[model samples]
Target: MLYKNSICFISFFFLFFFMLINFFFMMFFIMENMVLFLEWEIISFNSMNIVMSILLDWMSLVFMMFVFLISSSVIYYSKSYMLNELNLSRFIILVLLFVFSMILLIISPNMISIFLGWDGLGLVSYCLIIYYQNIKSYNAGMLTALSNRIGDVMILMLISWMMNYGSWNYIFYMEFMKNDYSMKFIGVLVILAAMTKSAQIPFSSWLPAAMAAPTPVSALVHSSTLVTAGIYLLIRFNNLLIDMLALKLLLLLSGLTMFMAGICANYEYDLKKIIALSTLSQLGLMMSILSMGFGDLAFFHLLTHAMFKALLFMCAGMIIHMMNDIQDIRLMGGLSINIPLTSLCLNFSNLSLCGIPFLSGFYSKDVILEMVSMSSLNIMMYYLYYISTGLTVFYTMRLFMYLMISDFNLLSVYNLYDEDYIMIKSMLLLLFMSLISGSFLSWMIFSYPYMIFLSLNMKLMVVYISLLGGMLGLLVSLMNVYSMNKFLMSYNLSFFLTFMWFMPNLSTYVLNYNFLIYGQNLVKFLDMGWGEIYKSQGLFNILKYYSIIYSLYQLNNFKIYLFSFILWMMILLLMLIL
Candidate 1:
């Protein structure tokens, strides 16, 4: 146990040291406006090259630095959270593997090598999700794995498609591929791949289901590394997808995802799942921005969102740990009175997530909203973005009211304490980052500033929506006197929002039920009917009959032998006459 704790400490130090070094490297690159690329061929065949490569620009460097930072913090927090568990070493190793995979993904310029990272992430995440060894964890792990496997399959197909160009390095060819009409199919496939990873629309179910994992895993995977992978991929390929009709479709779907996740999060009662849905909502926001050609803006939000969202999950972890793993928000209230520091962290992270002014989220989210307003979009698209933003504020406020402001709901016999300095210390690092990362990254990434020339109403659009959402959120929380009865009366509407419009059912049962039933029937028919008679049973019966007849003939049945000999002679004579 002491050795395991030492390993955690060493790992955290190593990651922190690397993060500092990368920070300096990022600053140097920014000063020189330089991009560093290095590659070595692993296989060469018929002018097609497969290589391991790295692309070090401001984007990859900064993103990798943040990944390491968050990973280090999560590891530190887990030392206390999982201290009593027997598999401490195993947990640390899985997390380290996850971080390594994410770094490989961040650096890779070649699609083939990217596959190594992408599939590594999927596999490692599954291991982490099912670490608890329970039915819920196992099911969630399967869903997470299978859903991501779709993206992996698409990526494999993409590698085959890119082989047409005789190179697997997408970075080198993105500009050329931009105008090539024949490569539009590749762009579509790429969008589908991103959709599955980022949890956009139909792929959104897995993200919330994955809340069954430990909270630290949720903080690392869902908040920063795993879910952001899709957005990162799209950001890298944004130039190629800029003009494709697929991006327009992506835009619509992403917008809908934002709205849908926001609505679902408001109705969710599970603390971790609520935060998981919030992560999903933010992913949609990033995807929507990327689809509109604001790759840098999307990337900006991705980084900032990572900081606050990870912190949010960590805070949620602390709460769930204190509450003895009780996750239902309905069973939790007035936690601020007991764990003030945690409540502070939770509220700050939530506010940042809601785009509160001067925080990390506001720096990126506000700009993204302004950019959305300035873009040439349809009215529905415009409304969805703003409405989704407002809903974000609403759900966050609702969560805040439920967890921090309401009356204490737990039994008096239970003791609550917040003396876990290790967890608190880990959270403080991200709490600091969540406060400043947005402005810091925004200044670093954007060379030429975005110009937003909009009318007065449009200029304050985000503010207006935020205010309205805040008001409604407060009203909803405090006005629950008769609302529960009314909600019970309107069961269908309540059920729809609460279950994310049956998205879990859609993905789990509706999607697989028919195919599963058909497969079962096919198996039965093959085993009991055609396959049985034609292959095993029929062949065995024929062999047995021949053996029995031969035995009878060998048993000195002279009449049978004579009859057989006469039949053969008659057959031979007829053949000769013909």
Candidate 2:
């Protein structure tokens, strides 16, 4: 029975792998030179006259390579991690399905095809997220699926609108959008779709909630695969978004998301949630940079973030596996001796996460900072770049210290290295790749910005300051200055603690608290002011009162008969037109 099972598994695995490989290459051959025709040959669609197939030669290749590498590693990692487990074959099938969908998403000929591929992956991910079949996993998966679907619904509507206007049929839609004034609306809707997939701002809560998934799922979902879909959409539609005011709104949203997530990561106790929120924060920063019109920088960051973040999560998984699935930092410590290799990889990844000089993260992240300075887009971006860079280092180092150095020994009750060598090998491979991939890709993308330019040079002063700021954060982490013990001891007097109790009041007085936190006061002021302006006397209030009075007056049946007749006539006219 065992031999038969082994043979069957191997046969099925090879079959699925080769089948997908063949399908993708086949699609590539057919569409190799197929220009992404928007509309049949209708009206004439011309955006830049630059061929998308050729433009995709480099960027699409980079993303496809990432998809394959990560997916392959995930399968390999799961092999050892799930050994002796039931439903193994089903898991492998899902793995192939995921790879197939993701690759299709990358190579898709147009927005519609890309979306089809994207939605397919979203479906696969929902199943994967709830794979454990526990209630919490189900709940988290449901929330994640619903959130992603909301984005999808917006995207579908936008696509339908674009198709109607012939944008999908660009030469197809030119005649249509030319008269519609709806491109702007569709563009904004598309960005909203991307934002949710990318986990920006208000839609971001689901991402961290998704940590309930198995560690591998968390690693795959957060580290530049699922979330990166949003960035990909924006990049693909760069020309359209360039002139939209929605781009600026997206930029501001990204900045706020990056800042808030970094702060929350600093407060999280679960090891997975720390990395989860960090992924959310980093994606936001990348989106902000891209929104500022630097797709190259965004792509570069996407690359490096994938490498280091994956390495970190896989290492976290190893740690959790050893501790019998304990994920809380409060229950971990002193694993440096027990899991030396894991510790080393974790430290290096953390350095990259902190954007230490010369690490992969440094090259990609600092380049965005440079762009912020160099671009004539917005002066306000400078503050966002500076402060978020600092927070990135702070929270990253804090998690590192808490997990590897701080004197928590609750994990002593459990073993801390039960993982198989296969898992460790996969992680080490990622770390090794991450150590060099960023710099090498940096050179490639930078030299070819029009084709592949990935800028390496940032403002020297800003780079220096950001590096120094990260170091300061590292120092604070090393000193254990912000340990939970300290916070608990002074819980009442703690600013964060007090603010937690009076959230409503703090929100109300945020304007008065200006200048305390870098952007908190400003955000508070805006929210409060906007709240009072809208809630107290905004147009909606007037409309609400009007609605009540109108309903009561309608009860009198004065104009009821005439209104009903007119409404019926209008409905009949609309129906006839349809």
Whole-model lDDT values for every prediction: 0.90, 0.72
Error of 1 at 1 (Å): 1.5
* Model 2 CA lDDT for position 532: 59
TM-score of each: 0.89, 0.73
Question: On residues 64-124, what C-alpha lDDT tens digit does candidate 2 reach at each position?
Answer: 7666666656666766666665877776677677667777666655667667777987898
lDDT at 128, model 1: 95
Q: Write the per-residue lDDT of candidate 1 for residues 67-144, one digit (tens) a residue.
A: 999999999999999989898899999999999999999999989878899999999999999999999999899999
